[model samples]
Target: MKGNPSLAVFGDWDADGIISSSVIINAQRHGMIYPIRGQAIIEYEPAEPVYLSIRLDEIGCFDAIAILDVPVIDRLLESMRSYRARCPSSRIIYIDHHISTHEKIEDLYGVVEEPLVGYVPTSRIAFDRVVSLGYRPGDRLKLFVDAVDLMDRGAMVPENMKGLLKIVSSISKALSYKRDPALWRSAVDWISSPVPLSSPIAGASMEEIARLAAESEKRIRDEANILAISAQKLGVFRYIDARRRWMDRGASALASMLYRKLRAPVILCVASRDRRHVLMIIKYPGKAYRVVKMLMETGIAVSIGGHSSLGIARIPVERIYDALEMLRSSAIY
Candidate 1:
């Protein structure tokens, strides 16, 4: 309730998350949200177990904090508690749409002032929440949110499609190819600008995004081609062991392609960079949550998160065989 409050904005390191953070920031800049005197914009990788990039102690204190498109994980819960204890009066607003977070909504309420977790894209949810505060967004911002909604929802667009849809897809693919915090921040700045539709995703120009998208598509195709040959049919799912391959990036795209090619659910397992954990990317037709729940219940997955038809799990590298056997016996068709 201060005259000019300081705010901190944290978003996941993805197109949807970046755009969602932009929606709130743009609202504040236009006097739609509170008139903030100062702010911090930080992007984080939600898939990681720990958010080492964010230093709560260094941030000092804030009037409010808005977390966008980030899942509710154990480490995040601990961090939020620490921040809450440090600044008891600070308002915290957490918003996300991942199924994993939705299942733990009760826990979220204990840490943040407002937890806007739902089934739609976080960009749309953020836009709607801002609108509910009696501020109308511009046509460009609305269009930008719609584009992110499509991308986050896994809407299929034709490869030759032209115009905004194609441009949005290219930007999403480019973001998926690499994890660049600077690039993500640039995207947020671009989205918050006046002529967002006219501008590229900040650090990367349109031509550069196109080049990255092309390269990403090729790498996905190459990885899928190799994995397809070694894919194992386990019960109703097609499992691929990707331990020998480096696929920290573009795992989602690779899984989607394999899903379409195999005409069945696809599970790709890749070892972490440190080789301490196994990352399982599951592209199930409609039972991704069930699969993830099973893994968690069986005590095989250390962390699990994602959407309805897509899920990601982290397990110890040694438990890979146990996870596969559990899935094989569950008959999760």
Candidate 2:
């Protein structure tokens, strides 16, 4: 089995995680033929211990496993050797940007991939990586992926109705119906819609986008208000006026900082759509750091305060339970 190839992929769960896995799988599906089988373990911070327990046992006889968007953490690479002892046929290939300390792990494949945004989620990375792998999707498909990536990354969307709907449907399906990779994307029509920036659902343009954002802001304040108040009150929220810019990332970055410093949920931070800045504080009080990881896996941004502790991320607004359920399902969050 050493010379023969049977490949698999594993990644950290985040928008990037989903997209990255999709890239590898899409590449294989489209004739890249590198990976024949795989499973992605989504988690906040890649929860090295949990991934090791589950994926280690699962890879008993595979020839290769591709690790993406996940952190191997200190000394975990040494343990890979332990796994290889039993399944000596296996080789590990890493395509990630978050590794430290190379001690203890012997001979493996490594490919560091960058995020469109500062450490963009895995899905966005996956979309571009798939293209780099030589599988150019149709314009519509590309637009759809781009739109979702933008939303997840808190960047701007192109003012195209078709792309917007495709993204909304795809994400909604993922959250509501468990649709994987939007197998039904082709059936959706891509049409251009004129949206004002100030509307509740603006995309690429500032006029309609502002309108959309205004509405979204109101909705969030009304429903997910507790989290929004954190940014509003503390005045720590950074808003990017540039379209396709990384607004969601700003929110995640804020969450990480608060978590590392406070280690509790007393800070209710509001991470809203880009095009404007928001600032506040509400009431989060538990392990605050875990929220970003959990939210990223689902391809959503986390609101500070109880929203993070509740395991709810800020996206779609209709699926608060979905995010909560995701966190509850995980042992760490």
Candidate 3:
């Protein structure tokens, strides 16, 4: 490793991604994995195909690139290969716990660390990795990482940490609704700073997050009611077409809300903004990947990803009905 190496950090747009990126940044600041000389070029959720290439070009080259919590999709793999060809010496480390990444681990062997199987969040993975490499996080970052991990897994926070969890959830909801890269970056910086996770961080302030969460909750509550009323029962699975709703912004939250309301497995079919494809967000107790596999095997899904209890699949809009039928008939669930 070179002394004072330049670095590039990329993370998914969610709270897990933001907090995981912060772990890496904190490690670099402490001169742990690599002695980072300058501020790393941090980016969140680089847009696919178009923006990815443009962003890579803008980043030029770095001595190392750290990718956290981002799924290893085909398009992203292609872009990473192109970047590698252009900068052969730039070491790239991808850390993710998505079942999609786990399925493709062989192809991504050298670049990706062995993903922790099941519900572990990428922030926990990143923190553990840095710790194994001799980087110890402070009390605040550790608590924040715990909050992110529990929240990502849809688990309840301890009563003592409920306040911290609320702050984290508020920020996550704000980011989901706002979809602002600057806010994401601000969140990473906030988590990396010495400010306690319980304290209201500036830039991505508590007031702003609260306002966004409130607005998002209002719309999501209305949409949830609609989904509850119209959700189709397919065997043991409940399916709802969320294409016409304003759900692209809060799809995750909406799915979670519906899951709780239905008290059974729910699948949401949300259309992409560009209408390029439909996203199937599956919320199941423990077999979400089974649903994704069935979709892939039936050729209903073009791409499949996500966790054991929550899965995401992309399929052609024309085959949405076919997918519903297959899930309706499948015995896997």
| Best candidate (score: TM-score) | 1
Better of 1 and 3 by lDDT: 1
Candidates sorted by TM-score, descending order?
1, 3, 2
The alpha-carbon RMSD values of the candidates against the true structure, listed in the order shown, are 3.1, 14.2, 3.1
Model 1 per-residue lDDT at 314: 88
Predict model 1's lDDT versus the native. Answer: 0.77
TM-scores for the candidates: 0.90, 0.43, 0.89
TM-score of 1: 0.90
Q: Tens-digit lDDT track for model 3 on 153-244? A: 66866898898787777777777777887787777778887665555565756788889978877778888988899998888888888788
Error of 3 at 331 (Å): 1.1
**Candidate that would win on lDDT:** 1
Residue-level lDDT tens digits of model 1 in 211-324: 987888888888888889999989888999888886466777788899988888999887776679988999996789779878998899998887778888889988988999
Q: Which candidate, 2 or 3, has the higher TM-score?
A: 3
